[model samples]
Target: MDAVLSRLKGLTADELREEIIKANLKCGPITATTRAIFERKLARTLVENAGLTEPDSSGGNSAWLDSSGSVVPPCATSATQDSVTGEDGDFGYGMGLNPPEEEALSGTVCPCNVENSQSETQTPSKTAQGSPTFFYGVCPLWEDVLARNERAHVYTDKKEALQAVKMMKGARFKAFSNREDAEKFAKGIFFSVKFPKLDHPSMMEADTINREKANSFKSPRTQDLTAKLRKAVEKGDEMSFTELVWSNPRYLIGSGDNPTVVQEGCRYNVMHVAAKENQPGIVQILLDTLENPDFMRLMYPDDQESMLQKRIRYIVDLYLNTPDKAGFETPLHFACKFGCPEVVNILCSHPDIDKNCKNKYNQKPSEVICERMKEKGQFQEVKQKINEYLEDRLYIPLLRATDNSSQPVIGAPWSPEPMENLSPRLPRSPKDPVMAVRAFAGPLSPSKADEFRRVWKTPPRERADHFHNILKSDPDRGAERVGRDLAHELGHPWAEYWDFLDSFVDLQSSEGLKVLEEYLSKKDFRDRAHEEAGENETSNRFKTPSPVRLYDCLQKRGIFFSS
Candidate 1:
């Protein structure tokens, strides 16, 4: 009976799915619409493999029991304690809701399907006086000793075991109120491995922790079978998988409904299992075997799809769109959760899939990808793929301007020097002294300022000689207002550059002095100008001039910096 219970507990979803698929196929071809009905039937056929079988509908013993032959009531067991004073308070064993007809070392009765079988009924035997009897934790005790496991030396009376342990080890130990709790701590002394199975509903409330370890426990046979199937999938043992599936077609639909809490907690289908496991080859085989090529071809009118693409689209629609036990999450969600870019790419390519499908959490699979990227460093590649998919869905590129012109894609604010749009363009020789000075200095070149230095440092006679020589070769041809005339000849954008130059040439003019002072004092002007010029590569060409460089140029012509 223990062996049977172990087997039932060990079944895995993958093994079940394979069995169902094979069982269904054994009958004949079934349409997608009829598949659900067939699958339910398939689940019943494979129940034995899942360790669940119909228990006796008539009450005698529950459908299943261990070899020890102990009968357990359907109601949950509770523990009770009767504390007795000695050197330490020794609590008596708990009593069960029903009186004992027979005693067994270990026993369990599980719910199962109806099957006819009967065991010899045992006559009630009276327990010895002061002997503990098994009882629920909350029930009142009849005698002091409620129950005992000879192997573990556990007594219902907590003080009895506590005194024994204290005397032997010379160390104080906690007193347990029930046989199970007493046995758990004292079992180590007897080198016992078995732990009591007390599945009282109230136990769940006491500690809500879900036992993942309990879920994983399985019988040896089930373990071996599960291993064989998984190994076949891992090794891409197509022959083995095919044979296994053909033999057990019912395993295909076995997992969908009334899912085994152990396997289908995530509500994964066969295909979802394959996708999450990253077994694309196995995935291909499952799709190829499960799908009807003729029906698939009819779904697409153009028939342009290659066999591979056709298979992928079919697989995605068949499996990727289906959510697992977790509501609204598809195979794509599982693939994304695993951070598999290869699987994601394949799923995204399928035309029928909703890349933007939201799960119960109102989150898209791409959003899940973003979250997973933070946990796993390798998922960055997966994140990139998801981002590309999102961009493909959410972003639309603007059309380029069709008109072919020499104009820039994004033109500057104004035309080069068409003050044609502004107030009549101040006369080339304005009446304002500042304007006249700006005009005369025309486009000062920081690089050329050294040439004017010789004139400034020279004697009066030499200065006159240098000035005339300058006039002969200078582009201004020694105009009366050399600065403005030279500036105008240099060009339009240089108006400001030349204006700075005028401050040095016409140093006697109050306006020129003011311009020079302003230029020197406003260091941030150049920074602001550069900022306005912009940092973007497309607009950097419009950057403002460097004030430091311009100041050096002025100082070269004997115009030293001042406040």
Candidate 2:
């Protein structure tokens, strides 16, 4: 995930678009008539979710910054705050809902997503839990070994034998929740891979998420596949159109009620195929056919940045608004990174383009490139052109750090000062001050290393540093909490999480910061006491060396992060 983000940050505007194109996200033929579907939904989502700030022809801080829309530091974005938390409504998770309310919405389920219900049932049928492929987060190189090897659980988690269940009487698999639990709550076992079967409800969610049309209309498999193929063109599929659609020309477009659309089931039609293949030309074609109001509405922001409009907006903005949103991002976020001219042109020239568009990350198109240019050799002349075109010199915020540090971490606000959008210099510290998060729990970069000096603000790494400092102040409190937090964020548990705790203790003891602090304070207290000759001995001179050591003989390199 971090690598994906880094690459996206590294790409030029054009390259980012190519990356989007290569991601094969768009599908279906684009049509001239599709404008008829100009229902407010697509526009609404864009206008509502995307920045309404008009593009400044003169390039100053976008209306988003200084205008009425701007709020304190975190910048109120187009997407609602709840969207960030991933929990919209229904409080106290696992809490019961009103029985009457549940009954009111009964019988409303859609059936198109039936496959997942059955898929979940099929999990225990084949592979055993101990299988290598079953191990979550195993390095890719180890996938084949994990698949073929039978002893993954032994080295990783020696205590609990990897059990193989032929079948459970009733296996009700809840992929997300169960997966999270297994990863978080399971016996903290590494190589603890549990592939739960898909569930019916999850499939339904995917249908809605992927934008698969699941109306009552039905079409024969033959005719259905054809329309699906046609829809793929505008969505951006090219090479894939012929292969998928031609394979079954006889299939009718799904439901006859919707003659224009293919009858095939949702999510995996020719549009998907084209998207998978990055067929931009084909996407153009499909978009042409679905000339209905739904075309623009198809932007899939949350799921992998799917949809042609999103891809277009993402690519354009990265080249334009960069360095402002600290390369705090994924590939889609790079449209604004410095040094990518080719990409910027490709994105800017597109029709229906919103010059001030911000991506899911809440950065504008110009923010992408402008900040980047500030990093490398001077882009003064180009910056001037940008200023003239946008009508303002933009001041975007740079992401705090770019290393293995975690992003999206809720850090407290830095002192008041506009983070002038500028490229951070090598020891990549941002000129724009940001509120530094205090007391985070995660891995620290190597102490005193060059990267450490600069990347300290980066998450997990920075969090790791905070952990050590806290340990010095209070080992017991710090060590206890560090384990759980690292486990959740790093996706490690047991050996790895424990190892971090152990190492921090050792470092504290060896460096003796705790001891040094205790000694200094005690010495000072004793001197004061001798002078006063009365006050009770300084409350039991701060306890000395803590009792913690490197316990894991069985941990990986990441867990041992002494650096």
Candidate 3:
């Protein structure tokens, strides 16, 4: 018993596990036992099996004790013989003896002898066939290894063999075309194993060439899952949607070319699909699932937020407010445009919802609802609900006193310069108030604002005339159109501000003209506006801010601002 224990201790963890499996010993699942545990279990199984066997001719206690007084386990002889013959070896083929016989013969053998004998016996047959078969073998052991199987594996195809080795839990693999090489590898004598040159060179060369390009292609399983998810979302099948998304949270997080939720052409995520289909339940489920701690960890495993609840909140907010690629519209935008008021209300209730988010057209959810109401002659109630929600949540005081305080000026006072002298020459403005406002207001400097105020010093009726001319020349003939153009020109920093001005002040009315003039005349407003614009400028000469930068800035600001 002591000698048998000593022999078991000399074997590696993998060898111990292989012996245990051959002995048909139940050590629970393969993943449950550690190396020390495997040694103990195999040692106990061997002692018990030896007791059941009859004594040898020398009248030793059992067949385990030989005449030389050395311990030889019952199964060791047959295992050693199989290693040499290369027959009935367990190379993940399950070709070994049945459990009852296997238990009676289970024992440990040196890996080098096992590998060399098998290779010696098998190599001749392989060579005679001239098929150039490359035998790939792997034995998975312990939780550290990543193999799919708990036993050894042998493959003829190099690619299949390499893949199996990678999937092994222990991450250990050996591939060799030479018998001596295989023996060295099995004994852990070498770090690298080399394969023989095959007739078809492209098989090895193609993997290296296409490795990078292959990264951009989604796996077939992921593609299939995405297809099924889309179908469930489109059909408003909440049960199927939850089952698919919840079971595979990693897919929902999206990475590289495998966006779990989005469609191929339009790039609309599942949120957009649900909202467009008026699936309020699906939207609610998505929100709830995103808040799951386990799911959030998968989405943001390295989140800087240490608190689990806070990290989940951050992830949920991102998914809730994320916009689609095609229209730059959030799910809320789609809800207002195509879904019911219930869907809009549900979205609005989210703590981090961006009610003032704008799409590529610079239209907000309320504005989108209004357009839908006009075009389809429906969603009037939805529009009213969204407007009411915005008024309550995003209300900006209309009666706040405007400060006339002055700010310190930098550089020389503004002076008219030739368009050619400007680094990025300003957009040429035609001789019209509306086009001039569109072009000049974008590059509004403190000096330019003062010039506009001076020009507008005429009587209220005259100011009304200028405003009326702007209205007449406007192609859309809408106050909102002028506001949108100005907002688009100003870019994202003050888009919501311009929208606010357009919504509250009726540019078509004379009274609204008085309010606009008063607001523009404020010294503080001009200074702050110029300062903000200057901060965004890269050069002294004015140029339109980039749309991409504008979008990034707006996203950073969470797409909401107070006027």
Candidate 4:
């Protein structure tokens, strides 16, 4: 003890201070108490640096630090001076930390040493504290020790291990066999923070957590039960559906419960199979069985959608709308395309259903039906039924004037962007009142005439252009000419006026003449005609409704002016 003190005293103050800083020991103002503390701390460091401790002989040996702060050789020692090796094998005080495990020295380094010139180097010591343990500088199975601290997380159970993993902010941690080992390793070292050093409670917490996990599933989705349930759904066995559901409340929680349950032959999950096959009852039962229905289910590799969006929400915005793999169609699109009117009706009526949602080809469900209608005459009724189901939400195909007046004109289908191709005559301004009216009118079907009539309240100027364009594009304009030829009958003084009316009168039969007299005799028409005659109405003939008005009158009276 005196020699150890003398050796420590011989160290320069700077060396002593360096040792104090290295071991992370507290250094207060030099006083009797603090000076004694420094001497003791320095003595321990010197003993460690001197390589006086026994070499490790066990296949896996660890540092055996003692309460008295001394190191001992791994070789057995007796009450003889020869054991200490003081310039010879002589007895010296040992750390007395751990009982010597073996009979002879195995020549392994026992403890860290000071005085690098006198100390012999050996392979770093390894520990027996199971895997994920660390040595002074070696971590054989764990990650490379990038950074370390004196404080280490110690856990008795997995619950504590996991919790420590979260609370401990380092990338990795070291395990210790006992609290004493942990305390010794943490002694006189710097650590960023204190970790929870817990015991048996951690085991209790782990057991409790495991029990909770087990209880979450009322019945485990075992192979037999899941297989039976899937078979029932595929076979449309209502009895099996009920039985399986009653047996395991969480059976339909997710598709991940059973990966092999094939429904309706496609790779889709059971919900999709039920929806595709028009099994509404099965679909409802499956939906009711889920705990968290809002979690997204896989449809296509690229698409993901919530169960509510799939079954209930009729309308979703573009981003949330996911299309299935087959044609990138949604369930509603599939229902309508496959002629599942019952499913279509349910999905259509859902407030969250996006009726106008387009498929992979950028075609809406209505467009899909219409396209099918062109190939299958039977689909005409289906189209009508779907339209009836969709009512105000239905899309109308655009119309253009055709040679045959009685036959409805079906032009190119309407799209979201109506101004994709504007007629050169049409102004580029999308907000132009005339253009909006034209675009709105472009998509109306002959069947939607009533809807058009109710909604097509264009401003008078735009309305006039709408009429002029319609009349000007009429291929069979003989009826319009017949009405125009009546200009001569204004009872005006012009020669051209008399000639025109005489020609029109010559062409009329007695019934036609009577119909013409009744139409021209209307008080509004007569008054307008008198005013027009006084002001040369022929030049302003383009604005006159006489052409369209007469056309309407002829059609109403069942008069055929053209062959």
Candidate 5:
């Protein structure tokens, strides 16, 4: 049971799900969402199913009484067992057992069969308090033997067993608590080997020795170098810092004796310190020196070239993006907060920089700049530059796709001009042509329409209130036509909802314009529209809106708007 539980723990979530399905266990979606849940549920099911199959005559006793009358098992039984058998000439000698006992441990008879035979001949008292049992055998594949001879080796120490396992040619041996697990694992492989559990006291002593050896590697000289390196960063002396780092690159590895300075509970590394001090040169020097191949070799002299290169990349990334201990703010966050545009620009252009990394407060570096602007009434220029940088990072590909060479078709079905003297005239009410004229003339002036277009181009947060002011002033204006015209101009999909405009206007009057503004200005809604239009499909194919779908959504939200 312990072996099976251990094996299940090693499986990934997807692999565990596969195992559950193969076992024909009933599992729901929620159970399959996490690896820990899947393991627990599956382990419970296995234990329960194991309990159900132990009563058959062919099935041997799942457990036996130990010397203390506690339940143990022969042949290392799991939670359940079907049978146990050993063939003649297939058995090997047990460790520390006499030659006379070898016959009793012969392969021709099953260990459980011997127990059953002994039970029938011996009294209950003798069988209940039997001597301690030991198992010994070699698997059919002799090529997997660790020791040259067929003799089984006993391991009372954990370190020796681990070393033995590591020394095996194919590392084919698996250590389990008992023999039944060995048999179960053997079914999937051509060979199997097992090692006994190590004594607890020896393991603890070995751990202590290893810890002592590791501590011995850190000398007074290394501590002095670390102190000097940090001092150079504090003084903003780039040449001294560079010399210290290049002399022994290990000085840059960790926080060492004098850990990074903490301000307001936030621990700052050398990069953070440099950025906060507005020393762009020091930051640049650190960046260049940290990634140098020669410095990397000096730091990790024992590693292979491939492994050394990978470690160097990881170290460089950690230096760039490691968050402060308290706020989880990266060095880039410090640069923005200190209003150092030069440092910010240097960090932003680096290929490995994580521009979108959020702090514990869920604010990105640009957001930090915005918050600073609000407090100090400064950094407005810095805020604008950061926003521009973010926008370029996010939308450059979209801009490249929509560049002037492959221009989008922009005219919708309706004309942008006034509807007074058109040849194909708009629909009019037969009872009141004057009323129809007023409705078709539209309420917004040309400048107001232009303002609406400009509002859409701004950020989403800025659009809502501006839209509310524009649409609230004249609720019955031909706002729908203006929206369609603006959509055509910008190659957006809002124009596709033209037929539902009356429903939207009714919704605005009933629920207030804020609801309408939120619906149209939602980032998710715009993204969905773009996805539905196919990212590359930039033409203005203004389809009519489905009134039923629009009404259904409104009704679900407990809103009724007259059309």
Candidate 6:
């Protein structure tokens, strides 16, 4: 581990001060203890990842990958692109932190703001209609990890979890050997803010959760089994812990009253159970137990841990490797993406952990750090999963106008400067693309820049000339930003696909829209035009389609055709 980070493990403020003074570092009259911890963490971060011996006045790495999945690399070292971007500044992909992933999913159309206008409330376990929904039934591997943690009852268990997390603190992290083991270990130490049992003991809540959990066919529990596992490991009752868990291997293999089968939550394989708690012996015991016919068919999650154990012959192998072998992600990504930091020390060590990583379209982890911070918008060490990459990863899509109303260009950045000064020709700075589609631009599909114009009227204070000359040059460019805000409104990019599908319906309908036009246009006019003279131009009139056509199309798309 890096020197500073190693010292930062569960440190108090006074210890930090003494360490700073002993090291002979500068910075006068620092007051708060929290600041001391943050300073120390930051210092360790700089020492471990920043490559700069001196502290950065510039808020760490200027450019990084945000949750949006857009790469916001350093844009010329100078600060700020706030002209059109406002207080957030144009870090690159023009969208603000308001909707981080939306900007990234939006791609080039990541600029529009969704935070203020629309009211979106997600009831973590429920659908938008307040109905319930669930995906990935019975994450058996996940439950197993929880069970392991529940078994380990000790403060040191948290310490171990903390230490395990360090391996993932930097760029170029490691992957578990295989899916089963990895899934198990990840689940064991997975971060979660709302413990289902902790927050919702009500029957209604339990019913709702169990309904979802039942999909995995697993048994239910009020609190997670992890606390028990965590305690056992904490105390050194490895022998008792192992015996208690494996006492009836027969039960695991399904000879019990209910029989061992996959469940809805808390799944894990033996290998993962071992790696998550750093117990190679437990893993070996599992392998030994699996020789029975009932356990043989059962598979492990990702196999990295089992493989790691087998090769090195002990759990100690994990500690020996330096930065070269560590696989930490940004703390934000780790916290929110997975939900906890019990094993986070390894991940926060990397430099990019703080980089926004978002482009104009998506949100990076840092924007989250900005949120979890305190009253003045500050932070020391981020703890909550809600604000960052927790089990509660928000999948907010860009807003969809109820009708065919046009939204402003999202990922595209137009200049605040006027047109004549804007260069007479097409703008290459995606921020200022000449959105007008030429005649040859492929027929009005979403990607051809055909739908960039506004379908709605201008807002107050908006100039008509600006709307005409600078804002929009055609109907096609006026109305869409779907491909840009996919993270926000997941249906946007697919909007065109649906449109194309509807067009396919039109093709089959009385309209005969696609066939005649595309067909004759592609025909060798010279070869058959003379013989055909002017038969009907064959493309003159168009036919109208019935709602049934749409119904059929929706059915084909697996949407409820009727009902």
- Which candidate number has the best TM-score? 5
Which regions of candidate 5 are displaced past 4 Å?
1-171, 174-227, 255-267, 301-305, 370-378, 391-563
Alpha-carbon shift of residue 366 in model 2 (angstroms): 12
Local distance difference test, each candidate = 0.42, 0.33, 0.49, 0.42, 0.49, 0.31
The local distance difference test score of model 4 is: 0.42
Error of 3 at 461 (Å): 53
Alpha-carbon RMSD to native, per candidate = 30.0, 33.6, 22.5, 25.8, 23.5, 33.7
**Candidate 2 global TM-score:** 0.16
Candidate 2 residue lDDT tens string, 317-364: 332222222323322123334433333332332332345556557776
lDDT of 3: 0.49
Give stretches of model 3 more than 4 Å off: 1-222, 256-259, 297-311, 370-378, 393-563
Tell me how far the alpha carbon of residue 420 in candidate 1 is from the true structure, in angstroms, after superposition.
53
Q: Write the per-residue lDDT of candidate 5 for residues 186-262, one digit (tens) a residue.
A: 33232434332234587776666444222213222544644676567767888898877666554566533232342
Count of clashing residue pairs in every prediction: 53, 106, 10, 22, 1, 117
Over 316-405, each residue of candidate 1 has an lDDT whose tens digit, in order, gives 465657776666678677677767665665565444567778889988887787454345766667677655543321100111122312
- TM-scores vs. true structure, each candidate: 0.25, 0.16, 0.30, 0.28, 0.39, 0.16
Off by over 4 Å in 1: 1-239, 253-262, 292-318, 373-375, 389-563
Name the candidate, 3 or 5, with the larger TM-score value: 5
Higher-ranked by lDDT: 3 or 6? 3
Model 6 residue 20 lDDT?
Answer: 64
Select the stronger candidate by lDDT from 2 and 5.
Answer: 5
Candidate 6 deviation (Cα RMSD): 33.7
**Local error of candidate 3 at 130, Å?**
73
Cα lDDT tens digits for candidate 6, 1-563: 12345445445666756656655665455456456555665555444342332110112223322222222333232233323333222223221101122232222112223531121132221111111111111111222344334322111122223333342221011234333443443443433332333334596665654341211224323122344443454343557556544543332333222122222233332222333444434434433444333222222222344442442222112221111112332223323333233322222322222334442336554433333323332233434423322221111112222343444333221222221221224335644423321111111223222233132233224545544543344334332222222212222112222343333222222234444345445544333324545654333211223345544644443334223
200 Cα displacement, candidate 4 (Å): 7.4
Which of the two candidates, 1 or 2, achieves a greater TM-score against the reference?
1
